[model samples]
Target: MAKKQDNTITWDTFSEGLWRENPVFVMLLGMCPVLAVTNSAINALAMGIATLFVLLASGTLISLLRNSIPKQVRIATYIVIIATFVTIVDYTIQAISLDLYNALGAFIQLIVANCMILGRAEAYSSRNPPLKSIVNATGMGLGFTLALLCLGVVREILGAGSLFGIDLFGPRFEPWVVMVLPAGGFLVLGAWLLLFEWLKQRKSETELNPASES
Candidate 1:
């Protein structure tokens, strides 16, 4: 079991989500949307923002009502709260851009099932005050967004020879069709995971080797 945090709020409470506990790279939560809708940069951004809003809004509401929620039905209650925000996101996206809505498909609605948001609610938000929960959720949301963009931008550029639908390479350049495919998501995600792991390993080695410091 994880240690429970105190009421005190610190920078680490928020910043941990950005890198140390990134939902995608570090913690590996919510990979469904991460891989499914990240073929294009625009799609990835939209999904990330939607999930962020849900995380923040739900975290706030859950923190405020944490005491009242019965322990027996807490999980069910959390889902209800999460689903409400997801519904709002669903309708808003439909009104904003039909093309984007189609591109994202059912993944947007599936945000309700994202363990990252639920985990925050059950583990963090339910224990902390609203203010602290908001800060933590913001950091986590941004981290998830950053991870999605990393994959999306790379996939889009290599797959379509463009970013956010804007052409970068001319007609002469051939796009790597695999980058935009489902296999592309797996390939890119594996590559990113390897890179982060390598960096972490190198950092650990540096810390252990006192001689290298000299």
Candidate 2:
């Protein structure tokens, strides 16, 4: 997990979420929806975009009203605002696709409690201007979406031999059934985290090795 930022540049706030402090891979927030809903690429994309909408919308509101809300009740206020947006998102998703809505289940409503959203609202948005808050939220949301897509794409291809329901492996390829199961989420996510760590270490070593870049 990352520390709550009281002060930082806009770029730092935004970029940190994409890599150093990703909500899922690094910070590990909102695992329920991540594990439960990412059985396919489309599902993962839907969930990610839904979360992004809620975060960005609520962050803007929290930043604009930061001065009016008393510190003592700010958490509750933030929840209310987030819940409002979540409801809107939930209904919107339902209208667009009932199957997606059912697949997401309570996880959509649960977005209101996602620590990543509330964390930004309290730690960064509340103390910053609306523009900065939106930028930071955008970063966090996109990072979250990217992480989701990573698992989703891997699972869909291996588990079902398809991406978004289009057959990539043709009819002959055998699918890994376990890849679409609940355990698959954990396995894939863990694999991705390890892969990222290895790559990060390699990049650091490459940068530090004096003879290579000269």
Candidate 3:
């Protein structure tokens, strides 16, 4: 028999999805787009929002249909749900702003292939209650947004001398052209990952050695 889960545990599960087990920074599930579209702050923000929308929508639908879906075909069903939302977001962006839409291009449609969405559906949404599943999905989406925003800020400031379309360092500071290139994306992401890993390791060591008397 399965042990009854406490409400507090559910909250922990949800929170962990956001930070501790983030799909991008921690699990590193979806990196192709994260590195490709993050060349500019605007592009990064747009991709993050689009991903969040798809994750939430797909998670909710999957949770709702968990009981009805057969174990064998669940993966296929979840993929279809995800693909539908990706198409909706893609067309919506095209209709709203052709420039932004063109900037995103095939990357927007590629959200269908993002492992985070399907991973959440198969791992959490399929087994958890609807409310809990939504919370988990939201947390994971927010974590992804946070990571993207960090990358965007770094790239934009160095590459364009501006952030979100506003110049921050003024005219005297020449933009580093490399920051706007693909190589810069890889460099920035690699450095950030290294920093995160170092911090996490230090935290773990500190926690383990908290009591000097031992």
Give the best candidate by TM-score: 1
Each model's TM-score, in the order given?
Answer: 0.95, 0.90, 0.91
Enumerate clash totals for all models, in the order shown.
0, 0, 0
Q: Tell me the tens digit of each residue's lDDT in model 3 across 88-162.
A: 999999999999998888999999999888888888888877887788788888888778888989999999999
- The C-alpha local distance difference test score for the whole of candidate 2 amounts to 0.89
Clashing pairs in 3: none
Model 2, 100-170: lDDT tens digits are: 89988988998987888888788878888888788888998999999999999999999999999999989
Off by over 4 Å in 1: 1-4, 209-214
TM-score of 2: 0.90
**How large an RMSD does model 2 have?**
3.4
Residue pairs in candidate 1 whose N, alpha carbon or C atoms collide under 3 angstroms: none
Candidates arranged by lDDT, highest first: 1, 2, 3
Best by lDDT: 1
- Regions more than 4 Å wrong, model 3: 1-10, 208-214
Using TM-score, rank the candidates from best to worst.
1, 3, 2
Give the backbone clash total of model 2. 0
Alpha-carbon shift of residue 10 in model 1 (angstroms): 1.4
